[model samples]
Target chain A: MSFVRAEGIFQSYGRRPILERVDVSVKEGEFISIVGASGCGKSTFLRLLLAQERPTRGEIRIAGAPPATEPGLDRGVVFQRYSVFPHLTVRENIVAGESFRTRWGRFGGAARRAALARADETLARIGLDHVAHQYPATLSGGMQQRLAIGQALAARPRILLLDEPFGALDPGTRLTMHDFLSELRTETGMTVFMVTHDLAEGFKLGDRVLVFDKPRWDPTDPDAYGATITYDFDARNGGIPFQTPEETLHALRTPGPDPVA
Target chain B: MRWINRQPGTALRAALVATPFLLLFLAYWIGSEIRLAANPSDRLLPAPGTIAATAERLFTEPDRRSGQILLWHDTLASLLRLTAGVAIAAAVATVAGLAIGLLPHVRAALAGLVAVVSMIPPLAVLPILFIVFGLGELSKVVLIVIGILPFLIRDLSQRVLEIPRETIVKAETLGASSGVIALRVALPQLLPRLIQAVRLSLGPAWLFLIASEAISADQGLGYRIFLVRRFLAMDVILTYVIWITLLAFLMDLALRWLSRRLFPWAEAGL
Candidate 1:
């Protein structure tokens, strides 16, 4: 059985459908990149994987069993912004990631010293050791995002989810982050599912790139039907879709930006 | 238009800030001089010198009847009531605000009720508070709480709600329980905001305290002011009013300083 499976999942808010017939299966250590136009329920799919929300229909299984009802230690996630806790120092944030397993949600005495030592190690790995005592607000955007990623990794989750993790970064910073993420992925051998609007980014870091789009469209009622997986490309072999990305984007109806995502 | 947009130099800006206060004092002095010239013993507009003398006497001399310096006694009493009311309000608002902001059901149940309570004129129920609590310290302190509690809760809850969903989700994905989230995640973020909320509520809290004390109190700044009003002692009244304003201003300054000192990270967004 696949390590992660979502079979015929559907989701809707009130009367409006957002996602439908979203089926996917992943091996234990696959790097699955999800890409689509805005408002195509890419984030909704990520939310389902995180177990932050339940699908209106169907179920998701992890390691041949039902996924946890709530977001759990098994899955770690990073977002484009506001991913790190502002009140905590960078080192304290790393400690927080690990401290979730403690009985009182915090460490004390020797245990805290051990956690702090481990946090320092993680900080050095992320190249944030020098500013570990500083709060997130003082850091530049790229550095804050780096700290966010490092904080998530401290928990040692089995699966790592990245939602447009480098979308807010500058081009220069984005390149460096990509290299950093790739190295970390190789070292940990953890499964990663990243959502991105940048097509090149989707192909570059992903083992398999999954595209989400609406199969059925009603121009008069734009939201009548929801989005689903339209293409699943094997990105490992430099396999590009027959249609260029510009043509593909131009063909789809973008109905403005995705409000919920 | 150019003049309107023109920025003032630091020294010029300081002068501009002082202009209104200087003008007001000049006007008051002129008015008092005119009143005194017309009638040798004018009580309504006492001279600034007379007011200053009265304040000094009130500060240093013990009261003939009670053996307590009336000014200090009244100030201590009023401050005690304000502190008790505000501290309780802060504690309650922090917990209630976090709950309303974090939990969907708590918000659904309490948000509207809190909104309605805030809308109801607090002073309109002054008599009810007095009757229920029976004209004691409790009634006055309770009045301050009722007057500003709703506003504090609303401000704090709104602030909590403003915290990004992404941050909360990030915590959850790291396996933080609800208790852990409340204590480790939400409370630290809310403390600086709680100070801010308390600062904003100070004016209304002071108003409620005075109003309640004016209605029924043995020793308070408001009570003292009302007591001297019967004899038409403008100097005494003016001194107490100035003292009250100074106290409120200092309290606001202290809270602002505390917020800055404790949560330097929060300063960046502001």
Candidate 2:
């Protein structure tokens, strides 16, 4: 059985359909990158997986159970914008990782000390120990994003979702984040689903890549129809080596003759 | 020329701030002098020396009938009413604002009412409050609360609503219940803003307090000022006015200091 499964997922915002009849099955510990054009419902799909919003039709099951109606500790998410609580210092923000396990979102006595120590350790691992006392606002953009990622990881979620998590970072910082994420995934063997605009980022980080698009686009009835998964690529064994972004775009635009066949 | 664009040092900034007050004082002093020169006993604006002596007497001397320092008694009475009114307003506003901001149904029900209530000039309702609560401390406190409560609720609701959707979602994914999110995530952010809202409302709160006191109270700063005005005791009235201004300034400063000390992380964004 798949670790996470979605069958005939359909989503809409009032009269506007955003996703239509999409199906996805993800294995445990697999890294999947979802790539698509803007407004192609990549985020909508991720939201469905996280259960931030319910699918208009069909159901998503995680670990043999239906996904919760709301986001919960089993799923941790990082967005392009830093998600750290601005009112909390770096250390406190990290300690918030244990918010789900602790009673009333608080830790006390030995548990408090353990939580603090774990937060400190995560801070060191993320190379942010020096700024543990600083608030998120005082940190650099790269540092803030890193702190957010670290905070998410500290929660020990079963799956991690990223929505253009490195889109705002500079090229150097973006590369660093990619490496950090890859290492973290390898170390923890956590399932990762990242939605990215950059095709190269998706290819670099994902073992499997899913492309979403409107197969039958109708300009007049844009709201009536929504996107679906157009192409699925097993990126692990593709013969294409080091394609330029333009080449990658070309290959994705016209996925030639179903290589999987 | 050198100082035109450059930021001022601490002493220079202090002097710059002090300059306006000094000029205003000079204007008052010169006006008082000219008025006194024209007439030895000007009742409208007393000389600075007369105001000072009145202040000394008010501060040190006991009242003939009550054997209590009238200034202190009035100040204490006025402050107690102001504190009670503001504290109740803050508490009620925080809870109401959080509910209205977080729950769509509550927001739908109360948002329009809040807007309409806020638009109604609070002073216009003073008579109603007096009639309802009676001409006691309750009425006075209710006046201040009614005057500021709607504004506080509106400002705080807007503040709570302005909390980024991402933060709430993140808190939810972190396994925090709705109650936990409200108490921990939302409440902490709202507190600093509550202090700020109170600081902004202080002027209005004081206005309502004084108006209520002047209309009915036997002993209060505003009551004393209004009473002395009938006798043309300009020195006593001016002294009370200055004292009121000083007290208001101190209260604002104290609230600001408390906000900064308690929530240092809040100002980090600034």
Candidate 3:
């Protein structure tokens, strides 16, 4: 049985359908990369997985049980920006992540000392130990994203969700971050669902790359239809098709049901 | 050179900062000299020396009847009331703002009401407050709170709302409860903002305090100023005005310093 499963999920804001008839299943520790054209419900699907928002229809199950109604310790997420707490020092931010395990959401005395030690180790691993006392604003974009990922991983969540985590970095920084993420994945072997606009990054990091597109479209009203999983490419064995570039364009070319008179 | 981009050196910056103040002082001095030349007993615009001497006397001398230094007595009274009003308002506003900003139900219940209340001129409600709370310290303090509480609540709530959705979601994913989110996640971010709101609303707070004192008060800086107004004691009034401005500036400076010391991280963005 799959560790993560979504059956016939549909999501919309009011009458505007963002996603419809979306189904996916993933084995434990499999990195699933979600890629699509802009406004194709890619982040919406990630949000569903995070349980930040529930689907309009259908349910998602993680590890044989329904996920928490709200985001919880089982899952951790990193966004492209504003992921780190601006008010906390780098060391404190990592400590904050681990502190959530406690009832009060803070550490003190011996536990706090232990948490600080663990945070130091994390900073060392992420190559950010030098600036552990500094704020997030002082760090370069790559460093901040690194801290964010480190902070997310501090709790050792079963599933790590990344929403275009490297979309804001420069090309050089992006490459380093990719390598950092790859190393972390190899170390933890945790389940990951990443949404990305860059297809190459998706293929490189994901075990299975899912393409989201609307099979039906209304040329007269663009938002008349919602996007669904159009293709699920096995990314592990160089299996991505050469025609994948045309997949989205092809979906756009497809026509929808007749518009109301 | 485009002056916009020019970085002033320390000495130059000091001179630049002093220019407007110097110009204003010079103008005041010139006007006072001309008025004094025409009418030596003119109480409308006292000479700078006369104001300074009055300030010295007010600061050092005791009142004949009460045997208490009136300036010190008035300042202490006013400061106590201002502190109590501002402190209470800050506490209430923080909690209410957090609730309104984070919880949808609370926001729905109170946001519009607060907006409506904020619109009503506080002075217009002064008589009603006097009637309700009486002319004691409570009424005076209540006036200050009523004058500035809405603005503080609105500002703090807006600031709380401005906190990135990602930060809150991230905290939740880490297994924080609503209380924990309010305490650990939201409270730290709001403290500096509270200080800023207080600093911003101080002007109105002082305005309310003075207005209330002027209307009805036995002992306060505002009371003293209004009391001597009938005698046209311009020197004493001018002394009080300068003293009040200095106190307000110092309070603002202290709060700013505290905010920086407490949350050095916020300095970059704030």
Candidate 4:
């Protein structure tokens, strides 16, 4: 069964459609990258998945129920800009997602110690155990982002959601994050859905590339940025052992600029 | 450590910075002394030494009034009032700041009240407070709260609101609940700013204390200043003024130190 499923996703802002009839599906332990041009509504789709924004029409399921008004530990997220707690120790942030773990941090004492211990192991996994006591403001951008990713994974969520997690980093840092993430993914075997405007990112990361095409925002030309689902593909195992741009190009036979056409 | 050495160059630079100000202050002190001595009977030109002597007396034999060293009585009283006032103000400021800063609806609702409150000078509330609570510590404390709360809430709330929205969203995606997002994500970003706002609030806190003390039941730094004013003892008045200012400076220093401890990387400096 698909770990995530979205069908007939239609989203619009003031009559300007962002995603129309966009369908997406991801299996367990799959890594899917959504890529498109700047206005491709890639972030919007991610936002929908995050429940930051809801689709005008469609259904989305994450493990079980779709995301709701209240956030749950089942879905973990990493943003482009590392949103680690600036004043908190790296350990505190890593355990931030473990609501299910520390039943009573408010009560303090032993429960809090357990929570701190959970945070400790997470920092260890992220190779930041040495800096566990350091604050995010003191950390390098890459380190902070790594902490953010670690924090999201702390509770061992069913799905990890990423929205251009490497977009804010320098090119070198971005590549490093990609490699680290791919390796981490292998160890964790998580289902990830990442959004990026760079086509290269789509090629590098996502197990399945899903493109969201927002038609246009111009009201004068009513049909501008018309929202459409350009294409979808099983980026990991559709056909070739490893799919390259040529194969992706051949796979996307549609008239648009999308590879999954 | 290399740069922070006890080098002659550092000392010379330090002396260079202090030389001009020190000389200027000496000139003023000497000038005032000369002017006061030139007219021993004169009421206006009180010698700087007189103020120093009064400060010494207040510090040592504090029983200047009815065998009571006014410093002990007044500093103790003023500190008690200020502590209670600022602590209450901190609680109010923090809660209001967090609420308005976090919620748009709360912000919109409270902005107008905050605006109206900010417009009213805290000292101006002395009359009403005196009438309501009498010329007692109660009135004084209430006045201080009234005077300080508006400025506290308005500034801290605005600062809290100014925290980057993207950061909050990022934390939420990391499975942080609303409380965690505000306290962990939003609060830390707002901390350095809140510390700044508290520093600013302390100034007004003391200013209001003096205004209230000048009129209320007599046992604060402001009361000391006022009573000395009646006897034309500029020494006592000046000493008290210096005392109050020094206290404010110390409070500011302590706050700066605490802030540094909390966020060593904080940029908004003294």
Candidate 5:
């Protein structure tokens, strides 16, 4: 069986649909990047996979089990903002990554020491060891995102969900984060699903890229429709060269007949 | 040298702060001198020396009937009532605030009621509290809790709401249960805000405590001050007022220090 199976998923708010009849299957340890126009439900899809939200119709299965009713240890997520706990030092933040594994979400004595050791190792791997004693606020934005990623990875989750995790970072920092993520995935061999507006980023990081879009737009009743996977590209096979977000969006809006077929 | 141009240094800032107090003391001293020259026994504004003497007596001398220093007894009594009231309010507010902030049903049910309760004048219910709780320590403590509880609950709930949705979702994805999210995730962040809310509530808390004490209490700072008011003992009243102000200032400082020491990263943005 596929590691993650989402079948005929449909999500909506009130009468306004966000995702429509979406289906995708991810193999174990595969990295899939989802790119879409703004407000095209890319993040919503990610939230569904993380089980932060339930699909209104159809079902998702992870590891042969039904999709989790709520977010759990098997799925770790890093958002673009407020991903780090400000009340904790960097070391404590990393330790908090394993909160779900411990009883009552806390580590004590030997477990605490072990968690700290793991936190230190994660910090070192993320090149954040020097700021271990510092608070997330004291770190630069890139460092904070790195700490967030480290914290998410510390849980040793089966899948890592990134909702534009590097969207807020500067160009230079974004490249560094891309490399860091690539290296971390290679080392951990964990499945990754990232939703981003940056087409180049999606192409660079993903082994496969899924484009979500509205195949038909009714300008009179815009809210009547929702996004679905319209284009699937094998990024590693050089199916298409990288396109700017604007160009990609334009293409999605004005697709040729039988675009998906 | 250029006072208007440059920001004050630490020592200068300290001196600048002291300047107002010094000027106020001088004005009081001068006013007392003028009043005393007109009439040697001016009860409305006692001489600074008389106020100082009252302070010395209140601090050092014991009451003839009770054989206990009145100032210490009053201070201790007032502190006990304040501590009990604030503790009860804080505990209740924390629990209720979390429930209202995190759970949509709870928020929908209670938010409006809390808002309405907060709008009712706390002092207006002083008589009702006395009628319900009677003329005892229970009444005084209960009055304080009633006065500050709504405000604390509202402030803390708002603070909890201000916590980023991402943080809570992130915690959940880490396998944290709802209880764990409330305790481990939300509570720590709310503590610093709780301290802040309490600090802001101190003035009103004291107002309720003193109002309750003044109306009916055998011993308390407010009781002592009101007890001597008939004799126009301004010196004793002034001394008590200054002492109360000092105590309030100290409490605020202590809470701020505690918040910083306990959760240094709270004020630092995530």
Candidate 6:
């Protein structure tokens, strides 16, 4: 079985089908990005992975556990909004993962040492060690997002679910976070499943990108907004390279905000 | 910026705005004092000089005194009732907040009833409680509790509910059980708001103590106010009113100090 697998996943909200037998698979330690326009069931798919929502007619297995029940420590998730607790300090937020685990009478000293070590190391990676004791409100938006990333990474989960974690940042800060995530993923080999609307962000970070669209909603009209998987391929692994043909790139760059991808 | 609000010298602006009211208030006090002096009767409104002497005799002379005087007796009685009521209300309301906030169906079923109960003015319940518990501390304490518990529970429940969904999800995804998430994630977010709620509850409680003691009790500021009221002694009433307002002001400031000490980040302006 794949490390993270969704076999023919289908989701419907009140008789309106959003995902119709959508299937996507991420191997161990692989980086998969889902890119689509707004309302294409990207967040719904992440919710399915996070076990916040169950698919209407399919199964998602995370390291041999069903996503519907028994949420394991193997999956960590970060979102675009309110990911960090406003009242908690950075160090406190990072160590939240360890607070929930059972050490069986042995976790106090050694487990503490290990969680601290992980927190310190992740703080360094996220470049937020200077403000480790500061609350989230004191930090900038970029820093808060990085702190959220730090908390998610602290537990060293097998797979990470990132739903537009950087979608709300300025272009410069978004680039910086992208660089941090790329390097962190490379070194730690934490499998990442990301959802983003920015084409360039998806292109630069995705080992493979899944494009989705919702068919326009109409009972009789067949295109009635049923979430359909548009493009699914290993863009970097054996799948055809999506070469934009430099001429087209050069033509696009000549004007109009420099064609993002 | 609004014309009145955004000005260079805030102190000057505030003083300018307050000057008229302060003058009127001072004028009234002076007018009352002048009226008392002209009357030459201590029973009506004691002259400022005589009232000062009365206040000094009533308060400062008893500086060495410890257990019960007007100042000590009223203060101690009010504080004791306030503390017991606040403690019981906070403890019970916090539990109710958690149970009602965390459980959706539970809140939906009970919220309407809580709303109904909270609407009936708390002072109205005193007569009923007095009949049941007798005109004693229990009646006053239970009255304060009934007055404050509904608000404490309602405010805390809403604030607890307002905690972002992501924080809970983050904890659960990392293997936190329901209890752990509630204690760690939920409680911390709820605390600052709860402190403000407690302060709101305290204001009415201080009012209730004086109101409850007005006709029934033999001691307390309300009793003092009542004693002076028999002779149209407005000076004593005014003195007691100032004293009670000051006490409330000090209590509120103390609560704020405690909040700042415990949660320093909240105090630092962004």
TM-score per prediction, in order, is: 0.94, 0.91, 0.93, 0.85, 0.90, 0.88
Residue pairs in candidate 6 whose N, alpha carbon or C atoms collide under 3 angstroms: A215-A225, A216-A223, A216-A224, A216-A225, A217-A224, A217-A225, A218-A224
In model 5, the number of clashes is 0
**Model 2: DockQ score:** 0.50
Writing each residue's lDDT as its tens digit, candidate 6 over A29-113 gives 8788888877788888888888788888889987777465644577788889888767678887888756665432113677778
Candidate 2 residue B73 C-alpha distance from true site, Å: 1.5
For model 1, the chain A TM-score is 0.89
Q: What's model 4's lDDT at A52?
A: 73
Model 6: residues with Cα > 4 Å off, grouped in runs: A70-72, A103-110, A216-224, A237-261, B1-11, B17-21, B42-50, B62-68, B268-270
Model 5 residue pairs with clashes: none
Would you give the TM-score of chain B in model 6?
0.87
True contacts kept of each: 0.76, 0.55, 0.79, 0.39, 0.73, 0.61
Predicted candidate 6 versus true structure: per-residue lDDT over B10-57, tens digit per residue: 889899999998997787668767876677563654555666776676
- lDDT by residue (tens digit), candidate 4, B1-270: 586785668879999899998997788687787876788865554676666776787788946348876687789999999989988887888888888888889888998989987898767668888888988888888877888898888888887866766666666655565676666666667777777887888888888888888887668888878877887877777777777888899998998889888786465332
The whole-model C-alpha lDDT of candidate 1 against the native structure comes to 0.90
Candidate 1 structure quality by residue, lDDT tens digits, B63-180: 8988989899899999999999999999999999999999999999999999999998989998999899999999999999898999999998998899988999888888888888
Query: Which is the better candidate, 1 or 3, if ranked by TM-score?
Result: 1
Instruction: List the candidate 4 regions with Cα displacement exceeding 4 Å.
Output: A64-67, A100-118, A215-226, A237-261, B1-20, B23-27, B30-34, B62-65, B170-177, B180-192, B263-270
Candidate that would win on lDDT: 3
lDDT of 6 at A117: 79
Query: For every model in order, what is the iRMS?
Result: 1.1, 1.6, 1.0, 3.3, 1.3, 3.1
When summed lDDT is taken over every stretch of 10 residues in candidate 3 chain B, the lowest stretch is B261-270
The candidates, ranked best first by TM-score, are 1, 3, 2, 5, 6, 4
Residue lDDT tens for model 4, A1-261: 878888888888997777777777778988888877776677888778777777888877887674465345677888877456566677777666665233332326776798888778777777899988877777888898898888788767788888888888888988988888988998899999888877777767777777666544576775555566677755553434455566656666655565432
DockQ each: 0.60, 0.50, 0.59, 0.35, 0.57, 0.44
Write model 2 residue lDDT over B1-270, tens digit each, in one string: 586788989999999999999999999999999999999977888888898998999999999999999999999999999999999999999999999988899999999999999888888888998899998999999989989999999999999999988788888778888787888789989999999999999999999999988899898999999998899999999899999999999999999999999888887542
Estimate, for each residue in A1-261, the C-alpha lDDT of model 3 and write its tens digit: 699999999999999999999999999989999999999999999999999999999999999786568899989999999899888899999998989767888888999999999999999999999999999999999999999999999978889999999999999999999899989998999899999999999998888999999999999999999999999998874555454565564665567532110
Please provide, for model 2 over A99-161, each residue's C-alpha lDDT reduced to its tens digit, 9 standing for 90 to 100: 644558878789889999999999998899999998888887889888988888888888888
